[model samples]
Target chain A: MDAVLSIRDLAVEFKTDTGLTRALVDVGFDVPRGEVTAIVGESGSGKSVTANCIMRLIQPPGRIVAGTIEFAPERALSSEGQAPRAPRLRAPPFDIVSLPNRDPRLQELHGGLISMVFQEPMTALSPVYTVGNQVAEAILCHRDVSRRQAWRESAEMLERVGLDDIERRMRMYPFEFSGGMRQRVVIAMALVCHPEVLICDEPTTALDVTIQAEILTLIKDLQRDLGNSVIFITHDLGVVAQIADQVVVMYQGRVLEIGTVRQVLKDPVHPYTRGLLAAIPGLAPKGQPLATIGSVVGDADIETPHPLRRLADGRQVSMPQDSRG
Target chain B: MRSYLVSRVLGMVPTLAVISVIIFTVIQLPEGDIVSSTLDRLQAQGVDVTEEYVQNLRAQYNLDKPLVLQYFYWAGNFLTGDMGYSYLFSRPVNELVWERLGYTLSITVSALFFTWIVALPIGIYSAVRQYSIGDYVMTSIALVGLATPPFLLALIFMHIGFEWFGVSTGGLFSPEFEDAAWSWARFADLLAHLWLPMIIVGMGSAAFTMRILRANLLDELNKPYVVTARAKGVPPAKLVLKYPVRIAINPFISNIGLMLPGLVSGEALVSLVMGLPTIGPLLLQSLLNQDMFLAGSLLMWLAILTVVGILLSDLLLAWVDPRIRFE
Candidate 1:
């Protein structure tokens, strides 16, 4: 249970015309080293917000009200199993929440130690620049490499992402590539610097179903090769089952369940988790109408605290007394 | 790219031909050719208006020809650089147009550079700092510049030149250099007089382009690609200039075509108000007096400028944006 990144009691508030409204409240999770942690919930359930919080990319009008995201990667050996460099000392674990937005360390951490892949691949890359120029730009930003060297590395990374004809593809723009191919370029850009943590915010949500599976496989393969921690945000439970090692089920900005994939999927303690698992189309009985959860998760109840209780099987569940069986 | 350019240039021939026909027809659509206007002036002085004199005037000017034949004669002459005679200016149309073209282009080209140079950075600032006090102030000034007519601004500039700067009002030269040859001193005088018109003419267009760029940059700032660049640890300034500003400038580049014709003819009112020696005033006076060859040639020149400007802009747009280039 070597956690690479730990977020504790993270809360986010967004300013609206009415007043301030909470987007995330008392959410906590751990991304274990070299493993995938899936944040699964419906839209507006703060799944992406939690991922954004970890990346420190919460835009204006939404501020982190309370939180501490502690990132502590191992210092002895790099994630790629290479010998640690003796010249540049490794930085100690620090709270990302406390670093100012303009701090050099925070800027260095972005795309250097932690990187992100956004949802829409169609618009993730600039239209005016070539794929090689963009990927090389990322490398140039983080590393002390010459433009020619960066371009060469970019070509190799593009080939590594399963793109054919790396030389021709490097000269092409994002619009020239298909959606799936564009997603591969985006993944190459995110992984070019070999960051210790990669935050994928619905990386396959906008792709075709088959392309989605391919992208998922590409990400999983890249993660395994890089041996880095991944915070995978997705709404599809099937994707969770296929790729995630740990699952954190969130409902309306509140974490209702958190455990290993086997523990949470086979034995979901929270009623919302059970409801979600029951709603899966493939898991339903043949020719029968999909089962619907009768009880509604009240928005008002989120304000009052409901402490998470640990179960015998080592899964954590927030069981509000009124909804408990 | 070479083939595209050749095809685009070839495409302009038919377009210009069609536009030339429209310009000739529209000029003729107004009642009374140049002969009638001359006759009316002579008649006002109590000269006998004979039918033979009218026929002779018509015959001399080729006014008796059919409309289609007249178009062929004018079009043929125009293509060969023989722009016919201007009855109003009492000189060849080409001489009148060419002499004024140097002055007209100097004013318009400098004004265009002034507009872009002043507008671009301010536009980027206003958009990036959206509701900040500086943005609000710039936006307010831009609105004022947009609302105020160029002619009125020219007058105000003249007044300020007279009252505060003690500089002579109107024209691109002082009274001493009005008819003098292009000596260094006369050129210096021209440069001094040039700023007033450039600032006055460019202010309105600069305001318009700035607001457009601001709106465009605002839209581009929120796009996913911008966020992607920011996530790549690109500093805020470089991120903005490299990603969003580059895309936002496409509209600004596309505007070059429309701005060419506008800078030429749109200077008419301001030229008249300022009494500058540009083609705008000549074009206006020619159209008013129904001087057929003069007005026709001038209108034809405007049409040519517009078509050529559009071609230039399309080519530049392709160079700036890869999406349009391949398409």
Candidate 2:
């Protein structure tokens, strides 16, 4: 399978008042064409940071110390005899990290070929603009569509996100909607441009369980229909099990384990990955006194004095690195 | 909305009451009698002090009553729109105040427009090119304006204009203005005299506005939506102008409340220096002579202007920020 997106030895650091603090180190992953890849880790495990690096959203202090983030545009063209469908990434095509801050190529790909759905829907949108205006703005930014055409496209995209009464809702502000509706609006905004890759950084984490399920289902359905690669970052193991086809387990900003979801979940490797599995409750033997993994992967303090339970499994869960995944 | 308006209107009652109390108390605080002072001053000028003149003046003005009764009488007259005659000017207080109010408002309104039009673009540019030479230069100039007193700046500019451009430190309009019709040339000449004083007053206030706008713009620049706009491939210029000027300027509408009251009240100092026949200069002269009717009425106009200015700013803020819904 061709790599739809490739990141190699990605590292990020922050120049703080104290000194250089390494935020992410030697992190690399690939999203194969038309597949969902989950970057699983606890918060502050550099999952979202890596995703932000792809979008160039990382700002002052936190800098991409070293890496190569390449997204091949030519991959949209197939070499096979079959009709030239949208070519997916075959290999590393262009280095995103090394690109000039204001490169036209990066600008062309930002909302055109790539889009992102942030964690908090409330903050991700401009409170002053109507949903329809924001979505239409996204469309008109890349496409040569008239404002009227853009509005029509925005309504259609809202409808595609399962929002009923798209016409009326588009005229409403984000505050006028519920949390789920706002998330759908954000999803619609991201998908409006038909991006090649949708980098969702904890998109469903802020939602309730039922809404999370609904959003995950919507994302999966959209990915299948649009034939776009998905890079879903999450700390929830159950969510990873449900939506991720491939999983890259990260610890301390480093890739701890990378495999098909079945291989990683069913037959886990890597000590950190095994610990993550052991910490989750429902996955253990019924009524057998749940096994707890000992040792924190990131900044978690597992051994700190807490009510100790000597479980039969003899495994203790430590504090995870950063809680911001 | 009606309830809100009613509440506002009702709230003004207490405010006006407090103002009346303060005005009455302040006017009555002198040790010597008003008649005695007036008589002494006239006698010093070699005019005969007459008991009949003083008693008649007191009875006609109804000033012989107790202070509270005098206050009530004036308040009642004010409520009935009978502002009474000015003892000093020998004209109706309302007519005198209203006429001077136009001149005060003309200078203030023109200066306000000048401040906004000049400061907004400068503020935005300073913020956008922050840490660059342009930012440094603008900041330095703003600091000078902030530190220097307006009167001093007025003096310096007047001296320079007088020497270099042969500009005279005349009143607001040319001496020939009364003879000439209200033509554009006459208006232009009026503006030319008004410009220096306006700058002296406006620049003193506008430095703070520039600093505020720059800070506000920088804060808005850090917002996530601004980043999102950039990622949408919006050009740098459009991104800076759109978000900073359009969305971030909501806070600035509130600043109008402060500027309006200051411009209206502060007109006295600058007008005195410039010899402009504005309300500030007139009010000051009246206050010195204990010209109660003219001074009190003019101060009331200032109070009304301040309230209206605040209300206008709130309305403008609601219009600018879509998130603020009246309903």
Error of 1 at B268 (Å): 0.7
lDDT over C-alpha atoms for residue A298 of model 2? 52
- DockQ result, candidate 2: 0.43
* TM-score (all chains, Cα) for each model: 0.93, 0.86
| Residues B189-222 of candidate 1: C-alpha lDDT, one tens digit per residue | 9898888788888888899999999999999998
Q: What is the TM-score (0 to 1) of candidate 1?
A: 0.93
A1-325: candidate 2 lDDT, tens digit per residue: 5786788878899899999878788777677878899999887788988888988878877999898987765444222232333444352377888878767666756766788887887777778778898888888877667999999999988999999988889999878988888889888888898888888989898889999999999999999999988999999989999898888877667676677888778876455677898788775566777555654245344323222122223221222433211
> Which of the CAPRI classes, incorrect, acceptable, medium or high, describes model 1?
medium
Q: B17-60 in candidate 2: lDDT tens per residue?
A: 88777876776676644466677779999998678898887887
**Interface RMSD per candidate:** 0.8, 1.6
What are the candidates' individual DockQ scores? 0.72, 0.43
Candidate 2 global lDDT: 0.77
Residue B150 in model 2: shift from native, Å? 1.5
